[model samples]
Structures are given as structure tokens and as C-alpha cells.
Target: MSKLFLLVFIALSQRVQSFGIGSTLYCYQCVSTQPGCSPFNWFWHWSQACPEDGDTCVKVIERKGASEVVTRDCLSALKGVRTDIPADHYEGCKPAAVDVKLGNYVFSSIKELDVKKDYYDETTFCFCSFDNRCNGSSSLKVNKSVMFSLTALFMVIHFLILR
Candidate 1:
């Protein structure tokens, strides 16, 4: 009886270890409308483990005349919105447009050219599957070199004007 119990325990432990093979990905979860969380403070929101089949983390930003909305969630959470990203959807950000008739989703380098005015002034979706908390920030960041040059130019201009 002792031998049988020992073997059974070993088998069960192995099975349990197998269950832990696939690691779950975590993502930031938040909404711009959440009270006391406006303006998107990194500390205000929390990270949540994605669903079993959810491998993508998405951050959606929508801008109108003067209002903007930001949303961060597991891709699976936005299924109701109906943007069907194919399995081959590339990683990174792009202007998002939805088909008015079919309601299908598409992307473009320029938002205003592709998306209808009713959609918004701009809508961008950043998709990532490579890292945890990947959807936390905008994908397209200004080049440091460009910023440095711009700052130097501004200083030169200011000094020249003073003289």
C-alpha cells in the first residue's frame, strides 16, 4: 500500500508540473474615464494577468477635437468592438480604421486619410505580444537625437534674438 501511494503521488506531481508549463502574460488595465485616474498616471492603474488564450496586449487612444480617451486591456477584452486582427497582425502601432459597411478593422499610416470623420480625429492602436506591460506607452516615440537637435536650435535662436 505504501509503494502504491508513493507512485501515485509522484504521478500526480508530474501532472501538476506539466500544467505549469505555459506562463501567463500580464498587462496594464485602465481607462481614462476612471475617477481619480484621469490623465493616465502609471501608478494609478494595475497589472492583470491576461486570459489563457490572450497573448496580445493593446492600448487604444482615441482623440476628438479636444477630448481624448485612453484604454489599456488584454486584446480579448475588446472583442465586442470588433476589430479583427489577423494572426499575422504586425507588432507596433498604426492608424486604425473600421469599415463603415462591414465593420471590419484596417490600418493606415495616416488616420485622417483612411478613417471616417465620424470615427474621430485620430485613433491609434498599439499591439504587442513580446513583453509584459508593453501596452503601457505610445509606440511611436520621438528620436532622442532629433529632440536634442531641436533643443539646441531653440537655444541658439533664443540667444540670437536677444543679441
Candidate 2:
């Protein structure tokens, strides 16, 4: 039958070119400065004094200057706090702080420190595009419906191998 319709049209065009090769999007960042305060300040009373199982400080006093004193936590203020993967997949603005790793969509940040006048709280990890952390979008719509049902089963085996 024409070699089984050229081996099912070359195996459905190599499975639709391997589903258009893997897609990706991950991010991370954090800034905290305080040298006379006002480095994009917005602590809002230390994020309402964080507590719900999230808050492990060593030095917390984001502002109390007379000579100098503006500490923070999460290990020495900030400086590239690990985990990063950002080539600009999404983020229009509002990335002053982010940390949404829910279900492994990944996103982390921390860097930009120097407190003394009191101004430390600038976490980051932003990525948006329907903000699901950029998962495979339903596995690319189920691999485009299995590459259009394998291109209609290779056009019905090329019309029964050219009849």
C-alpha cells in the first residue's frame, strides 16, 4: 500500500516537529536599598508583619536612622537570591517583587541591597502571559490534537495508497 503511505507520512511529520520544540519562561529578582531611604519604598508595615509561615529574619528594622540602621532578612538583605531563568518571556510591569513557584512554574529574585536610612523590601520573580507560571499550556493543546490526528491519519494512508 505504497509502503503504508510512506510510513504514515513520515510518522506524522515527526510528530509535528516534536511539538514545536520545548517552550520556556522563568524569572527571579529582588532589590533592597536604604541610604537615606526611598529606593522604591513600599514595605506597608513589613507586609503586615508577615507571619503566615513566611518570615525568617535576622535583622529587621527597615528604618530608624540617627546615625544609621536599616536592616532586613532572608540572609544579608539581598543579592541575587538564587533561582533564575529570565529571557523576557513576560512582564509588563509590577515586578518589584515576585515569588510564585506554585507547582513548579518557577520564578525567583533577590538583589539590590544597601540599607542604612531604612528601605529594605524589594523581592522579585515575575512572569506573565496568563500568569500560570508558564506551564505547557495544556501540553500545547494536547500537542495540537495529536498533530491534527496525525494529519488525518496521513490523509487516510494517502487515499489507500493511491487506490
Candidate 3:
């Protein structure tokens, strides 16, 4: 019994030591309308390794007026910041989905991005995914929203033109 117990202890210790190697997550990043991060271009580029404390890759989009900011990085990537909401602190890559709406933007601090400009009713979307460079694809999900809105607008215009 004692020998078996010792073996189990050793196995547990080995697993603990190996944990360090698997902690990091790789993700892609790009600002608004960049040709480099487009779906076709992303695969050819290198990814950023998430910090040990960052578990999942995150894709965040914020639109204010005609200017939009898009960023892809590790979840909770921002550290040591004083904001209304504390930064999310995660330890390893995990799968998660979140959607929230707040004053033309979603999933981010209202104060972080200046809202003083002509606030066009915009929807901010934040997506998190696990696996290497997952954020790149997740960020593309935003395009779907844009496409849907455009399609609806086109139909409306067509109706008006026909009338």
C-alpha cells in the first residue's frame, strides 16, 4: 500500500511540473480594416503568445463614429490598469462566449474608449476562443453583423426606390 501511495505522489508531481509548458495560448491581432488580419491573410502571419496568466484568446471590437478599433489578444491581456471595471485575470486557456450592450459599445469599459464623438448606434462585439490563433477567426464574426445590417439597409432602400 505504501509503495502504491508513493507512486501516485510521484505521478501527481510530474503532472504539476508539466503544467507550465501547456499554459500559454497563441492568438492573432490587428487593428480596424487591416489587410494583414483578413481571413485569408491571417494564416500566413505569426501569432502572439499569450501570457501565462492569460487563458483564452480574445477578439474585441469597438466602433465610435466612423472610426472603429479592433484588437485580438489574450484574454485579460491588459494588466495594471485603473478602470471602472477590473481587468479579467485568468490562468489558462478556456472556452467562453459573452455578449453585452452598453451605450453603443459592448463588453468594454465605457470610459476606456472616448464616447464623446458623434455616437452612431454601434454594437461592440467581444469573442473569446481557445486554440492557436483562434481569435483571428472569431474576430471575423463581427463582419457577419455588419453584413446583416447592410443587407437590411439595402432592402429598405430598394423598397423606397420601388415605391
lDDT of 2 by residue, 10-104 (tens): 77677555432233212111223543222323332222122213212222222223332333323212324432223332433222322354224
Model 1: weakest 10-residue lDDT segment is: 13-22
Q: Where does candidate 1 clash, by residue pair? A: none
* Residue 146 miss distance in model 2 (angstroms): 6.3
**RMSD value for candidate 1:** 19.2
Worst 10 residues of 3 by lDDT: 91-100
Model 3 C-alpha lDDT per residue in residues 1-163, reported as the tens digit of each score: 5456546755655544332246666677565467665333665556777765546665555555766666566655533421222234333322222223333543445754644322324433344543456666544333445545655675565557545
Candidate 1 per-residue C-alpha lDDT over 1-163 given as tens digits, one digit per residue, 9 for 90 to 100: 5456546755765543332335676678888898533455556676788885657888778888899888888888776554533344468777775455552464555766534345567778878876666677544233457655655675565557544
Q: How many residue pairs clash per model? A: 0, 8, 2
Model 3 stretches astray by more than 4 angstroms: 1-21, 38-40, 65-67, 79-125, 138-163
The lDDT per prediction is 0.64, 0.34, 0.50
Q: Alpha-carbon error at 148 in model 3, in Å?
A: 33
User: Can you give the lDDT of residue 118 in candidate 1?
Assistant: 52
Best-performing candidate as measured by lDDT = 1
CA-RMSD of model 2:
17.1
